[model samples]
Target: MHYTFSQYYIYVIFVAVMAAFSYLNKLNRTEVFSFFMYAIMLLFAVLRIDTGADYSTYIEMHEEAGKSYFTDLFSFTEPLYFLLLKVLYFFSDDYWLMFAVVAIIIYTILFLAVKKLSIDPALSLLLYIIVAYYFISINQLRQSISLVIFLYSISSIIDKKPGKYYLLNIIGFGFHYSAVMAFLIYPIVNTSFSKKTLTIIFILSIVLSPVIEKLFVTYLGELDTLYTKYFDIEEYMEKNYLALGKVIVPNLILIYSLIKFKSFTRYEYSIFMIYFCSIVYYNIFFGKHIFIRPGMYFEIVTILYIPIFIKKFFDLVTGFIIETLIILYYAFSVTLYGILINGGQGVVPYKLIFSR
Candidate 1:
């Protein structure tokens, strides 16, 4: 019923094929290639069973939702997600069918967002896989859906439409409260900072991270709320070193981008600020796991931002080479991280709906 870590190579191989297809048809049929790539990822996600850290947990929630009253279910999960679960439960009590439906929604939006927004849609898709977004999607279904919705709202930010941006974020918050963090985006993007000021703030965020951690534990830890429940100050402070691994790459990118800040187009500048906010959030909550979820709203932009940076950072030939290297590194590092460090976020020994 279960497959080994080697099963994940199926994705790597398919992505390789997708990349080749994209390369070969980039000019004439890029849209077709994009759909093909999205379809394969969609299949992998939809067919998965007993995969992801929350896979079993979600199955349990589905079962509970079927039996519980709607009001009771709302108490357990966000209203929109539970409402969707209840509606799906009405048609068929099958959990796999419900999961498949959710997967479709998530991938459809992600595909559309990348195709519409990314400068290099193919590379964005590859980064989605390599950056662990794919893995995160399978595990954190609600937040993944919310994150994609926020991705769409990036346009509103660029267009200077705060109303549309906040409206989208409010809708996203219905699925996951984490979308509440997304309200910060419009302000972040709109705010202007000189290159000198930006560098100073970035350094201050790093230098003062420990003070921020201590302040959070001292102040926010006292709150008895759903959000604060995950704050294990003692355990996290000990693991403070672990947060570095997550932020280092983004921090490096931010430093590089800041050097060329003045050269950025309006759209690119907005994305850079969003990316910058992600780093600042990570620094502010450096060691804690729960606090960092807010930053994911901004961090997901890396799928788009990295390509933009590559084009800005280097000439065409050099950019292509650098991107290729990034892809290879991400493919290797992310896969091994899943297998060894993450254990697939409980996705290892992957199963299908009919595996049993």
Candidate 2:
């Protein structure tokens, strides 16, 4: 889709409104306000038309799935996702219905996750929008569904129940294969890593990145799939190359969390490790885009972490100064960085399903 500078500001204004609702009362917004906030987000996602990067592509896929037999799509697309498309298509041929259904499922799980895990639900929901996960859902529907499913699995992870966690992630994998990466979280979070060790590992991942790329190209890139084709297509690969927001900003957050390492509760530490893995993957697989998809399973959890981190860090050390700094950063990042810098992932010039 085409994006313009004016539309970017419009998208920023939309997000600014969402932020106003989120920060209106961090401790207590009435249930009616909560309902309104969620309804706005849900409607924004559900009603969009030709607004996301993959809008037309997913529309084509939806039409194709409706016309094809299950066996035809099963070879490439995940079974459950194909099934979901088939079910939605069966109800109506309208592709908008598919987007609406997926939006409902994703936001529902996200809302539940924020309620269960977030120390500040409003802040977590705000991060969901400002951090671009909400927009990411508008674009990459299948993987976004899988990502939120992984979010739901955090409770299972924290409860230390391997069976339940695996079950949830297995369901996630059925939506997107990249969810296989989530299988490692149980062990990663369960194990304790010293701050020194995490730092060493982060440094090593960056230093060894070239070698990692060579290994991926020589071995993994040989696979004959759209994902693996990135290595061979110079232009495609260049466009998909890791961005500053994906790498540096996240690593900075990881560093910020590690700064208060000694005071971490088990739950907070688990959250930190999950986010840490996201940056590690970003660094280790720096060049190619396909390998980076797995990191999102971990990166998305940072929405939950941000609010808690801000609160804990505020209580322990920096006070409102750092809190103000973080809020300002989020405000700028959501408006300027997201729309102007990242192009809002092609979600500008927002249009509803009713629009031409």
What overall lDDT goes with each candidate model? 0.76, 0.75
Clashes of each: 0, 0
What would the per-residue lDDT of candidate 2 be over residues 145-228, giving only the tens digit for each residue?
899899988988788888999998998988889899888889999998888998899888888987876777788775534554
Per-residue accuracy of model 1 over 1-356 as CA lDDT, tens digit each: 23455766665565577667556544664577778778988998888888777887888878777777877755864888888888889999989898899999998989988887888787787777667777788889999999999998898888888899899889899899999889867876788888998899999998888787677667765553344444454554443323433566778778878876766778888888888888887876765655667788988898889889898889978887877776665655554443324464455555676685
- RMSD list, candidates in order: 3.7, 3.7
Identify the leading candidate in terms of TM-score.
1
Error of 2 at 337 (Å): 3.8
Which regions of candidate 1 deviate over 4 angstroms?
A: 1-8, 11-29, 70-76, 214-245, 338-341
Worst ten-residue run, lDDT, model 1?
236-245
